[model samples]
Target: MEVSMFGGLVLVMVLVVVVVPALLVGLVLWLVSRSTSDDGGAPARAARRHELLVSSVAVLAAVVCTVVLLAQPVAWPGWASAPGVLQAITPFSVALVLCVVRAVGEQTWPRPRGEVRSAPLARRTIWSLGGARLRIVLVTAAALAVALVVFGATADPTGRAFATNPVTLPDGSVVSGASGPYPGWPYGLPMLLGLALAVAATFVALGSITRRPPLHGVPARHDDAVRATSAARLLGAVQLCLGVGLGGALAVGGAAIQSRGQNLLLDELPTHGLVAVGGGVALLGIAVVVASGIAGLLAAWPRAARHAGAPAATGAPA
Candidate 1:
């Protein structure tokens, strides 16, 4: 299928902006958690089941959402269908983000000696990854919001027409064909930018997670791991962005092919596909954002939970 440059750009945006960062954050936190354990400086095998459970749930939700949205293929759907996706997965996203954040932070930060406060394995692992994850996510959201606004301003507002002209074939058969103004780069550029920002954010987030210990932990040397992860994330983000752009271009080209084959909405297909895919990308973006926010929260959760339940920390000597 031929892909227009514009459509390809959309695909690039999705990859760079949405998926890579989440994976990076997740991996970093998992590593950090594994590196540090109470019994030994190695990750506890016991936490594997719980970690898998959270990750499984998140992936399942994403898959279900993709299927549902694709299957339903909203005709005049409500304002981009984000509200629906968010409502369905917010809880799961929130939980995962929190877990990752706490886990990552605990492992990375320099903890005070003798201040080894015990925390649930799930909490530790999740929060350790969560802090950086949350920041990346917020940035992704802001970027997406800006992209949407730009797309709105530049999108083909006339939209696809329900009724179309019929094409006459040599065999004297008539087929329905729909035509509309080209979906131009103006709309696609914001998406591209959003995707770029998302990718860049992911790379930075990974760096934050792996490069140094968390804000509050015993410092351990993971410089090599940190550098490696950061580099990988950066490269991955760029690849994803390229994918987004390329993917969109292909879809559009596909639409063109289909249109040529028969009277179909070829002109509109690629752009529409990008828009739809963009929503999916946004979902991934949200996951990243949610992860980051929860991490930040996890960094604070232990103290917050304790403070809420116990007496305040006092300046006076005990």
Candidate 2:
């Protein structure tokens, strides 16, 4: 029954991560294509086409990476083995890579031939590109990562099963809920490294986006919108990844605590607090998972950046 339930959960996740986004992207692209087709301006049409092409490629690459990661067999040591590690890392890795690809693609935006091009005098920064939403997401992810590391470090080293407080019974036998799996250095180390790499990749991608030349033949507002959209997407991806990881960690830790409470010996100990604590943690984890799914959806939806009345570029020749 547990296996079946887990399988069902996996199916739901696959649908969320893969099928839903693909359909939405296809629908959006079709609508955009139709709208662009009816317009008769060459420059506008070209800009839209270039945007579509780059977006499609980036989405495709991210989806392909996700599939490969999910399907590949990996052997990881510790309680949270290959599946756990992959679950925690895949979202962030795929999203970060997608951002990088899109940033690189933006650099290649076509310029009009035999025409003078203008550059913006205002310098672009990561903060300017992403706005408040980006900062909030980044700070949240960083906090979660830190918490996970601290929890892992403090946990007793259990190999495969959850570490529980040892209990002594009147029968002169000592028992524990489980043994062998604790989020110790072994588990924490790899996750920390992966997160660090993800942060580095995110900065690199954002830097690329900020530094890329403005799109020519498009209105200044159009160029701002494009950059803002890209930043929003990156922020969404980052939020999704970290949120999922934090949720999973909470769920696992809660399960460990609940297992201890469920031990038959605990029934006679006159204390049932662990059960309540565990349940609360588990519920919070579930909530986080749901929120992460929403974040993923938001990331998939394209939108222009919401700048607070920033002046449009004057299109002065560089």
Candidate 3:
């Protein structure tokens, strides 16, 4: 049964890793070709081309990292019990790479020749570049990370075999409530580090987007629109990472708790509180996982460049 399950999971992973990226690359290529054919001015075409290139590079980097990680013959330390760590960290890694790519892309974006450039009157920061939605997503990710860390710290110290406390029943039998492996410190530590790195990368990327010279010869509003779109995508990636991480953490932790609760019930324990808590956590985790899918879509969805003089949207800076 376990082998069959593992095989099914591998198949699913292959489908996701291979199919999704192919679709995205195809979409990006279509956009690039479409942009090339458009009669837009040189500045507009240049902006579109640069944006599309960055998008393609970022997607490629993520796909490569994911394939390499998944293809490893052996699991990393602590991975046996916390398989969710891979699922969570994969997206985090993608987000981190995306940030780095965006930062570099912004810094190196083409500049108009023989044109005078001026800085914006106000200095821009990550907070200034992104809107309220971005901030909210960041906060949500932080909350989930904190929860994962706290739960991991409290996990039982048993290594390799089981992560939950063993329950002794009336029949002289010992049940380790949950089967081996839980998201203890071994898994949590890696996730925490990844989160920290992702945060730093996001900050740097947003800062670059804000500070980079405006697209040369483009209207200021168009440039602002471009920056805002970039920032949105970056934040969307961050949110997707955190959302997946949190969902995995909750699901694993909850399963452990639920197993313990079931054991207690079997042992005729006094109360069923743990069972309720575990179920709730698991359900919440599932919900989060679903929401993360939406976040991923938002991150990958292409935005058309806003033309000059268009009415300002809700998320764009004034």
Better of 1 and 3 by lDDT: 3
| Deviation (Å) of 80 in candidate 1 | 4.4
Q: Write the per-residue lDDT of candidate 3 for residues 226-296, one digit (tens) a residue.
A: 66767776676567656666776676667667767777788676434878987898789768766765665
lDDT (Cα, 0-100) at 245 in candidate 3: 66
For model 3, the superposed segments whose C-alpha errors exceed 4 Å read 1-40, 77-88, 115-123, 159-180, 302-318
Supply the global lDDT for candidate 2: 0.61
lDDT of 2 by residue, 62-81 (tens): 77777776654434345544
**Which window of 10 residues has the lowest lDDT sum in candidate 3?**
2-11
- What TM-score would every model get versus the actual structure? 0.34, 0.79, 0.78
Candidate models: Cα lDDT each: 0.35, 0.61, 0.63
Q: Which candidate is the best by lDDT?
A: 3
| Predicted candidate 1 versus true structure: per-residue lDDT over 182-219, tens digit per residue | 22343244344544454444444444443332222212
Q: Which parts of model 2 have CA positions greater than 4 angstroms off?
A: 1-19, 36-42, 74-87, 112-123, 179-184, 264-266, 270-272, 304-310, 313-318
Give residue 175's error in model 3 in angstroms: 6.9
By TM-score, the better pick of 2 and 3 is 2
